[model samples]
Target: MFIDEAEIEVFAGRGGSGCLSFHREKFVPKGGPDGGDGGKGGDVVFVGDENLHTLMDSKYKKHYRAKNGSPGEGSNKTGKNGENAEIAVPLGTIFREDGKVIGEILSHGERFAAAAGGKGGRGNARFKSPTNRAPREFETGREGEKKLLKLELKLLADVGLVGFPNAGKSTLISVLSSAKPKIADYPFTTLIPNLGIVDCFNYRSFVIADIPGLIEGAHTGKGLGIQFIKHIERTSMLLFLIDMTEQNPKKAFDVLKGELKKFNPEILEKPMLIVLTKTDIDPDAKFPKRIGGIPVYPISSISRTGLEELKHYCCETVLRNN
Candidate 1:
């Protein structure tokens, strides 16, 4: 039920019409115009809620409309305004119209107006003139705005884990944080992205995201990688996880980098670290101390070897960058 994208239509309320009435009294022979003005319409607004993590609610509901204003009454009394329509959405939700970016919600309780209500019409009393005592002119109300919007949700995390299938990304994240992702020996085990909050010294914490594995040609929709790759765009740092038992760790690192660069070249500019996982499985295996000028950290999720050092480094690096 983790929906990331949805399409919906929004409609604003319409204004009420003006009332035309003539004042009449038992004693007076002729009374002037005593019309009342109409009330304004309501707007369609979207609110951000941090408790929500997906766009599932928007997926089922397609259309939203606000309440219409009431008509004006006699005796120069104005009508009541319509009620607003508010829709709750998750943080990091982006709204688009006709493939163009309109706005985004990144904080809790943030509101964005998708459509505006129409203006109210003028009453006949506003058209009273000294020369024409019995003028009966009245104005009509205007229509509200309507639009079809697209919603896209992107995860917000401090660090992103990048690696091939079965490269111990899930295992590493589980050990580093409290996230429990489905792990198996086969490829494409993780179909969705998982987020975890890693606590550091002094109650400081940072969020980490573990997305689906990436393979060669992932940018071309080769596997599940293309669908989940965009989830890493918000991360401040990246961790390149590689299997220490691989025949050539350097080639693996190169493929991962190539896929990421192909999807978004800007991702390469972010600060990154190379991590060799499952070190306990191959204690004697040899890996380069550094890959492509980036330092390496070898750790075993099962035995918890080199985990404290890695955690300390990640905490300090993320804090320093922030």
Candidate 2:
């Protein structure tokens, strides 16, 4: 039910038509035009709410439309305006029009006008002048704007955790951060990415995301696909967790790096820290010397060993990158 992307159509309300009426009192006969102007239509707006983490709410209801304005009445009485429609979305959501970015929501309670309402029509009373005593011509109401919008949610994190399955990624995030992700001795336990906020000394805190592991052929829609890899592209720094207990730890790390390169070469350009996880199982395993000239660090999440070093390294790496 975690929907990250959705396509929806939005329509603003139309303006009401003007009324054509003449005043005819009991005493005063043939009174001048007394028609009232029509009210304006409603607008469509999108708001960002931090409480929402997924786009699942919008996925259920695709079409959104505002209410139309009421028609003008006689006796110079203006009609009521239509009520506007508001769509709430999570923070870090991007609004796109025809694949182009229209706007981006970064903070809570921030709102953007997606579609504007139409203008009200003029009444016949305004047309009455000295030249024409009984003018009957009145302006018509204008139509509102309609658009097909695309909403894409990208988790805003300071650092991203990326690696292959069974690399002790979930355990590392759970131990380091407050995010209690489902951890097991199996692969693909985490289907969706989890976000956690890691706080360091001196009130320094940064957001970390536990993106699902990527496997070989992930760029070609194999082994949980490359969606996990794409999510890491937005992170300021990447923590590549490799299972040291694997028979070929070097090849495992290489495959993970290769998948990332295939997904986006820019990902490899980001600041990366290699974490050799599951060291408790095989503490003397021969880890990789260098993958693309990046040094690897051996750590065990269960034993709480080398965690401080990894945390320090992550903090320094993030600061250096910034």
Candidate 3:
């Protein structure tokens, strides 16, 4: 189950109460007051881990609470502090509180404090005065912080691959990376987006996301892109794949572009590449050199022709963009 969004509640531990006691000895009739201070409360923290790709764990567990602090003991013995609650999430996770984004974790081992613990109270010994020999007052512990959070995951990748269904997207990604996605001849074969790490020359590589296919009504939530388009918004570059054998390739490109524009015009502003797939079908066929102002490249994944050049170009383009 690939879950990208979740809601959870986090609470920090409460501080311990102060201790009050009077010193007593057999030899001395009246001994000064001897009391211990309370221990601190536990905090709730969130950490980013590269190993986690989905927010499925957060979806299953909706609430989290930290351990409470221990109370103080007599004879100036402080109580033990409570342990902290650590929550691990994937990179590119955004934390939102009350419909507004508070912070985001983008790197591995990144730590963010979701809620802070309460401070411990003071002991009666701290209240002792020179004028008053016996002062019987002590401070109380503070309450922990509590918050309701919304977690949203935007997949991190260097390049985003977008195309209509049956445009050879899965086949192309299979050749570019080790990811083995289910491929079919029909439309909408891929129900979920797949991330593949494309290895280029000299073992240099970058990440690519194969977003689900889009259709004419995709922008209106008629197809898969409505749910997967958010993934492409985070990418630095985009690859628009079109079928060369289609009756009119330019018209097909226009439809795809229109859908993307409707969703978010900013997406079209990114660095984009126009790719015509299935070039192996007609080696002698001629197509337009460019789509609008963007350069168009012809390639066939099965024949492996033009693939090497494409890989090197992708590597260079990503490096330049980075």
> Which pairs, if any, clash in model 3?
none
Model 2: weakest 10-residue lDDT segment is 227-236
1-322, model 3: which lDDT tens digit per residue? 1238999999998888877877888998877777777788889889989789899999999999887777777787787887899999998898999989898786678899888877777778778899866668776778889999999996577888889999988888899999898899999998888888898767678888888899999977877647677667757788889988988877888888898899788989888888899999999988787887777889999898778877777898887776
The digit string of per-residue lDDT tens for model 2 on 125-162 reads 88899998887977666787798999999758778888
Global CA lDDT of candidate 2, please? 0.81
TM-score of each: 0.60, 0.57, 0.59
Q: Any runs in candidate 3 off by more than 4 Å, and if so which? A: 1-9, 12-91, 94-155
| Candidate 1 clashing pairs, residues 3+ apart or interchain | none
lDDT by candidate, in order shown: 0.85, 0.81, 0.84
Per residue, candidate 1 scores C-alpha lDDT tens digits across 261-299 of 987889889888899999999788777779989889999
